[model samples]
Target: MKFTKETRNAGRGRRDLLSVAGAALATGLAGCSGALERDGDGNGNENEDGNDGDSDSGSDGDSTDAAELRETLAAADPYRMHQYGPSHVGNAGGAGPTSDVDAVWTFREGADDSHYEIGTPAVVDGTVYVPENHSVGDDGAETVVYALDGATGEIEWEWTYPRGTAFGSTVVAEGAVVLGLGGSVVALEADAGTERWRLERDFSDAVTVADGTVYAINTTYADPPTLVAIDLETGRERWTEPLADERMFWPTPPAVADGTVYQGGVELTALSTADGERLWSKDFGNAVTGPPTVTDDACYVPLGDGTVAALESDGTLRWRQSVERGGRGSGLHPVSSPAVADGTLYVTSAWRLTALDADDGAQRWTTETAGDRPPVVADGVVYASGLNVMEAYDGAEGDRLWRYETDASSSSGDKVAPVVGETAFFPSAGLHALRGADATSD
Candidate 1:
């Protein structure tokens, strides 16, 4: 859905703009606060710093997490989800492709039509799953989901629907490529690009997988929006719940951790992954601004008020850290989705990046003008994207190591995170795979 000042409630006016812009600013740059749109390829991670690659919410949550269906992807080799995993840690283990890197390969999908933007990317095993939009017969447009070889830009397999287009992340689960395609939740065979199952929805932007279930928001014209859960193997609805009727923030793609699904709409809500049941709910004076980043210990919620509300599993308030100002068009601006590593939380607030102590919400370090795209943390580096630049910073010291300038995707709400592995795969003008300049090209 297109978000604008005229459509949203007064409380959510300024909060939803961070994604409208690109990369969460360069070092201390400026966070985006325009219009959050989408159109792109989606991708997946490794665990670093002695972090258990698998989240141990320390509860029964782990047992129910079907993310293991894509087991090996837990390593950094594959970026299975948009934010890396069900936990939404946004870490893909090792280091990022530094600024000195060179483009290993690029799959340009630019067309004359404005809606002909590429989708995000998802990497698993050695295949990169992405979507490319194309202008068809004059004003018509269609998106093609392609499974490309990771090492080479060869199209291993591709698929599209009749006059259908896709937006948001591409996910791999239950041994299939899952995506919000053709206005439906689609699962296609990873190796052959064959349809496995399809669940129709009038509109959907993001799709996430957990414990053999697919979670996403579905809407039909004037009907109220509903978050629906679909079985991974079958195209059957498991449960559906009505979303907040108000003009609130509902993260494009919801997140799941510890057997709980986290979403932002009327409020930050935690629901059971087993069934559509509310586990807990909290209000921080405004709707949730960005995707909830869930870790082993806390569920960090970015609020429209420029505050990061740290809450426990039971919805208990842990702490709140304010940004330069509220999400409104005043001070620094509100914060967007954050990446947590070790014990520090890397947040892109308006035109800056701030590192906060995960335990007490104390500021560890802050950048000057930050990029606005959601940050992806790996090894010890944090990567933030912008419309024309990608900045890498030391995860510990917050020092700007290097910056690479490139054309970011103009797709609506194209806030897809960067994929970190042997090469850094960014969803931009198309799909750009960057690697260290010293690395030998195959």
Candidate 2:
């Protein structure tokens, strides 16, 4: 129940809007609340491999019909912990290899009224661009986004977005910091904290940038949800595609790969990355709350009701796997996004953590953590948090390597996400870092 504080608080008041921190793609409204920490750059690069870690390139396979694509994405990978993609491993070569000494640097909160909560952190050059929620008053009002030293957590510069309510994560690419608030998306100068351009729209969705354009969706309870692609430089709308049904309040961020942008609503939808044309759409079962993992010819969707599905790149369901069949109680629900590492997918449901084969959807291993926070895979290890504990697990196998406990209350079940670099970062009673046994190995 530790990670559920924010949602619980919001649930007690008004459950329509929740305020999420580091993971950025948080549901609900902002207030004095708890948040999940997040790593930036989805599947960017891992230091252990010598492969060229280009963010845009992926292995290609022969294209199939949209129906087959949906089936392929649904089949479930036997080797991965997530299907959407890997949680960020931090900026390329920023921190040395994970080691002992457990080094952790934190920025002091801006003011009593301003508590520091992070969105996804982006490490570029030597700087970690963090989107921070600085609470302005007791009403949950705040200014968001900050640029900091990745290694030291020192504040380099900061800025605010217009009409920005603290929600969703910052998307940093090509020297620009981008994020979405209650109804608009804005791009800022990553270095000087200057505003480049802003897209005004009624949406709280995070913007995915690729091919010099931004992809955003508006699906709050107030309006019909539509996915919109916009030019990053000029803030011009490229194309807009409406959803199948009018269901609102989606927390899943858009995943972009190859020439397509993959996302899910009440159902799964794939759109052409270039023209915003609809490529495919599939109904999994329940709505989707996280990003869909994409392969050259396949896509994976982790459904809200605890089903892991695989689909072809064109949107056909291949197979499905459920975590509850493993004798775990159905009370564990997956709201946080899953992380993929080394062909294995990691997912968190309420109080349970699971790893599955990316190719088969077979349960490789399952373990109970302190709370149900999403796991971050790095250096062959998974970093997860629960209740009041932070834990590390063998990424290849579900073996407990180490555990760290804190007096800080664990995050609410509805809001658990972790970020990993050379070290993994978690926010509990305070902030926590998990490093490897060695300190000097880069």
Candidate 3:
């Protein structure tokens, strides 16, 4: 079950100078309890990429349509792992919370009278699986994964871990909820929150589960990270492959789509989901900002040096577009992962949001905003979370639809992206579920 390849850096990347320091900054959250280690642009970028989750269970049977979410989420890829599924599309699809949203319920609990941050959630059959790590009594720490009723935002069951660092992502698939906790990959029964399996490692990133398999990226901190595949039914390792020969400081989780698993690091690689077979890898001369957004026809990735690149299935470059404004002293170097829905690509940079045609990478529209996390598209609206602000825009016209200002951490990419279930979930120290005042399930 050891998948290793002697793959070295394809070429010296442009950001190699800061790789060592950046990696520490990227993975720093693993050291703290509930504190997020994020690469911020004040615009939504990765949703932090792999914070997403999945489940085969039915919907909440409310205004949110789980069936519809399953359909559109599966349109390009499975809701395999986090960051809004394997395609990394960030589209909740189906019946999402529209304009004039109201808080239906909020999922929050304090440990020792202090609140912890909530990570991304995966909804299945009406339950929300979310994880959080909190400090206890100034010295102790605890990691808890709660299974909440999507309709009511009430905790139905929770599984607690002795150690923290597992708050990065919570994923539910194949009747199991999986997450990375304190350098280990843990799986629990989705309904009972009972421990199903655990695999200890040194360093673990966000996990992705697809087609009864769990893909995990782990490292020992002394070397580079590795991509590991595990059987969902059993804790047995399927295969593990080294993602980079040289270390990657802040690589996002792997995206599984179209029978291919796309991994980003110093290089962008495509692998076979069946076995750890390398399909193609390209040295982009830059670092990948987030998970690769793989669509039916092409794959898109945000580069570290502030640009977005499109690739064909064969790993060939299609087109490269610069979302970075302020080249000649504009001082704007916006970097975030790309979210694609309805053949449109959305990226948020420093103080601006840009929409582009998914085909050919032509600019569709751009608007000035304060978003920093990767944008989430659901029901044709782009949800951007920035410093003390949340704004929605028309996916096609790029017009500002509505704005909701809040005390929520502007570091939304680290806490929770826009998780649209029966309602659109936002993280503001606690998990908030919102639904449109006049919206109905389709």
Best by lDDT: 1
lDDT of 1 by residue, 346-375 (tens): 877654778899999999988853256678
Which candidate wins on TM-score?
1
Model 1 misplacement above 4 A: 1-75, 109-115, 164-166, 220-224, 245-251, 325-332, 440-442
Instruction: State the C-alpha lDDT per candidate.
Output: 0.63, 0.51, 0.62
Alpha-carbon runs more than 4 Å astray in model 3: 1-80, 109-115, 220-222, 325-334, 409-416, 419-422, 438-442
lDDT of 3: 0.62
Q: All candidates' TM-scores?
A: 0.78, 0.72, 0.77
Order by TM-score, highest first: 1, 3, 2
Candidate rank order under lDDT: 1, 3, 2
Report the Cα RMSD per candidate.
Answer: 11.3, 12.5, 10.2
Q: Can you tell me which runs of candidate 2 are displaced by over 4 Å?
A: 1-101, 109-116, 137-140, 162-164, 221-223, 249-251, 325-332, 386-388, 405-421, 427-434, 437-442
